[model samples]
Target chain A: MSALDALQATLADEHAALYTYGVLGARTSQSATPALYDALTAAYRRHRSRRDQLRLLVQEAGGQPVAAAAAYELDGRLLRSAQVQAEALELEVAAVERLLALVAQSSGTVREWALTEATWSATWQVELGGAAGTWPGAPELA
Target chain B: MPGRPLSRRTTLGSALAAPLALAACDIDPPPRESESSPATPPPPEDSALVAAVVAALVRAQSVLDAAAAAVPSLADRLGPVRTAHAEHLEVLVGAVPEADLPTAGAVSVPAQILPALGAVRRSEQRLQREVREGCLAAASGDLARVLGSIAASTSQHSAALATEVTS
Candidate 1:
C-alpha cells in the first residue's frame, strides 16, 4: 500500500471509531458509570481530529480521501461497562493495524506520525483492560 | 501493503549500484530450475535487531517476575503483563535464525512495589527505543511492520504500568 492508501485506510477506521463512540456516548446506562461518558466523549474528539489529519495526509499525497460508509454494523449487545470497553478495545486494535501498515509504507516524519498514532491506539486498548498484545498492529503475523 | 517504495530504489545513473541494492533486500528472488541455493545470512543490523528484541523480552519478564513476587497485592494485575512479555518473546524468537538466537541473561528485580514499577517502566522505555530503531533499520516492509507493532505494544505497557503505580 502506498502512503496515500494507508492514510485512507486510517481515515476509514477513524470514521468508524467516531461513529461507535457516538453510539457509546449516547447509551444512557453506559454513560452513567463514573468517567465512562467522559472517556467516550474524549475518544470521539480524538477520532475526529485524527480523521481530519488523515484527510490532509491523503490530499498531500495527491489522492482523494475516501468517504466514510453510510452506516457501520455495531453489535446491539454493548449493554454493560465491560462490553463497551471491549468494543472500544476492538476498535483501537483495528486502528493499530492500519497505523502499522502506514509505518511500513512511509518514512521520516510520516512514519513518525504513524508510529505515534499506533502507540496511542494501543494505549487506548490497555485502558480498556486489554493486554498489551505482542503484535499490537499485525495480528495476522502473530 | 507497500506503496511506491519512496527510498531504496536506485536511479538510472546508479545502475552500477543495482546489484548491491538488490542484495540489501532480504528476500531472494525465486531461482530457476537446477540452481538451488541456500538463503543468504541476515545482515548485521538485522541480527542486531533480533538480539535487541530478545534482550527486551528478557528484561520485561525479569522485571515483572520480581514485581509480582514482591507485591502480592499487585500480582493479579501482573499476570497479563507477564503473559504479554512471554508472548512477545515467543514471536521475537521466531524471527531469529535458530543458530543466531541471542541469549537473554537473567535480570534482578527491585524489592519494593514502587521501585519495581519504576524499573519496569524504565526497561519498557528502553525496549521501545530498541524496537523503534529496529523498525527504522529493517530491510523488509514486513519486518518493519512487526517491529513497529512491538514498539507500540511497549508504549501501551508503559502506560498501563503507570496506572498501576498511581492506583
Candidate 2:
C-alpha cells in the first residue's frame, strides 16, 4: 500500500481510538479514573502527532486523507466504568497492531516512514501494556 | 525486545514462502485414524467429571491470562496463578474420560493491556472474579470427586481474587 494509504489507515484508527478513550474517560466511575484518563489523553496526543505526519505524507503521495468518524459503537456491556476502560484499551492495541501491518505492507521511503512511526506508536504501549494478556515483557503499558 | 514474536513470519515473498508459513502454523503431525470412534462406552461419568474439572482449570488459566493482560502491574503475582491453572489443566487432561480425549486449542494473548497499576489492577480484579466463578461452576456437578477438585481450585482462585479486589 502507498504511504498515503498507511497514513489514512493510522488516522482512521486514531479517530476510533480517541473516541473509545473519550467515552471511557468520561463515563468511568472509579476513584482512579483520573489515571486512566491521563494515560488515554497521552496516547491520544501521541496518536495526533503521528496523524499529522501521516497527513503530510498522504498529501505528498497525492492521496486525500481519510476523514475521522464522529462517533463509534461501544458494546452495551462496556457502558460500565470498568468494562469501558478495558474496551478502550482493547481498541488502542488493535488499532496499533493493524497500522503496524499496514507499515509492513508499505514500500520505498514510505516504508521507512511508516515503520518508524509504527515503532513510535508501539513504544507508547509500554505505559499501557499490550492487550495480549500475560505473555512476556510487554512494553507501552499505561 | 519483549514484543518480538516468538516465531515471526520470514515473508518469503508469498508464493515461495507459503510452504514455510504453513509449516510454521504448528499443524499437528499426521494422525493415525482410530480403528473406530468409541461408542456405547461406559458412563465414564467419573472421567466426564474429571474432564469438567480439568476444563475448570483451563477456564481459570484463561481468566488469569486476561487479568494479566488487562492489568500488567500484577504480572508478578499473576505468574503463579497462571502456573496453578496450567498444572490444573495438566492434571485434568490426565484424568479425562476416553470419550473426552483432550483437544488442542489456541491460547491467544488478550488484545487489551494497560501497564499502569491502577487500570491493570481493576481489570484484573474484574476478570479474576469472572474466572473464579466460572471455574467453580464448571467443576461443580454430580461428579462430586472430580467436580469437588475443581471447586477446590476455584476456592483458591476466589480467595486470591478476593484479596486483590478487596485490597
Candidate 3:
C-alpha cells in the first residue's frame, strides 16, 4: 500500500481501538480489576493520542483522514477478565499489522514510531496470555 | 454503525502550508529524483535477507531446545516458545533455497533452571536485536515487513522469558 493508504489504515485501527477500549474499560473497575482497568485506560489514551497525530499526518500528506464510526460491534457477554483481555489482544494484533505496513512505507521518525508501537503490541500480547506467535503482524508470510 | 461524514474542508486553506505541517508531523515529503542519495544501494531481495533471519531462528531453536531439556519444569512455559521459533524457521526457509541456510548444531543444555532460562532469555534478546537491525536494513517492503514482525515476536519472547527466569 502507498504511504498515505497505510497511514489511513492505521488511523482507522486507532479509531476502532479507542471505541473498543471505551466499551471494555467501562466494565472494568479500578477496585475490582485495577490492573486491567489501568491497562484499558492507558490504551484508550494512547490510541486517542495516535489517532489525533494520524489525522494531522493524513492532512499534511494531502489526503483526507477517515472519520471514526459511531459505535463498534462487541458482545456484551465479554464481561469476564479473560474475555476482555482476549478482545484487547485481538485489537493489538490488528494494530500491529497496520503499523508494520506503515513501517515498510515510512522512514525517519514515523517508522520509529511504528516500530515502537509494534513492540508495545507484542508486549501487551504476552500480558494477555498470548505469545507473539511466529509472526506478530504478517501471519500470511508465516 | 456507519460513521457520520465529517468534512474537514474547513482546513482547505491550510493546504498551501502543508510542507511545514508535514515536517512538524514527521512526515517527510517524497524526495525528488535529483535529490536522491547515491551512497545507499537499493534494498536487497528476499533471498539475500533470509540468511540473517534463518541464522537467528536456528540459534533460537537450539537454545530453546537445550533450555527445555535442562529444565523440564519450565517445559510447559517454554513449549510455545520453541514452537514459535520452529514456525519462524519454516517461514524463513521458504524464503530461499534450502542450501543457503545454515545447519545449526545442537547446543548442550545447562544443568539448572535459572541458568537454562537465563541462556534462553539471552539468546532471545540477541535474536531480537539482530532481527530489528535486519528489518531496518531491509530494502524490500515485504522483507522489511516480515523482519519487523519477527523482531516484534522476538521482543515479546525475550520479555516473557526474562520474567520466567526471574520469577
DockQ of each: 0.26, 0.01, 0.24
Off by over 4 Å in 2: A29-31, A107-113, A120-126, A129-142, B1-167
Which model is ahead, 2 or 3, in terms of lDDT?
3
**Top of the candidates by DockQ:** 1
Can you write out model 2's per-residue Cα lDDT over B21-140, one digit (the tens) per residue? 111111211222332123322233334444544554454455556556666766676675566456545444533324354443544444444333333344334544443233233211
Per-prediction TM-score: 0.75, 0.41, 0.76
In terms of lDDT, model 2 sits at 0.44
The segments of candidate 3 whose C-alpha lies over 4 angstroms from its true place after superposition are: B1-46, B104-109, B162-167
lDDT by residue (B59-89, candidate 1, tens digit) is 6677677677877766877776677667666
Q: What does each candidate score in C-alpha RMSD? A: 7.7, 17.1, 9.7
Deviation from native of the Cα of residue B90 in model 3, angstroms: 1.9
Best-fitting candidate, scored by lDDT? 3
Per-candidate local distance difference test: 0.67, 0.44, 0.69
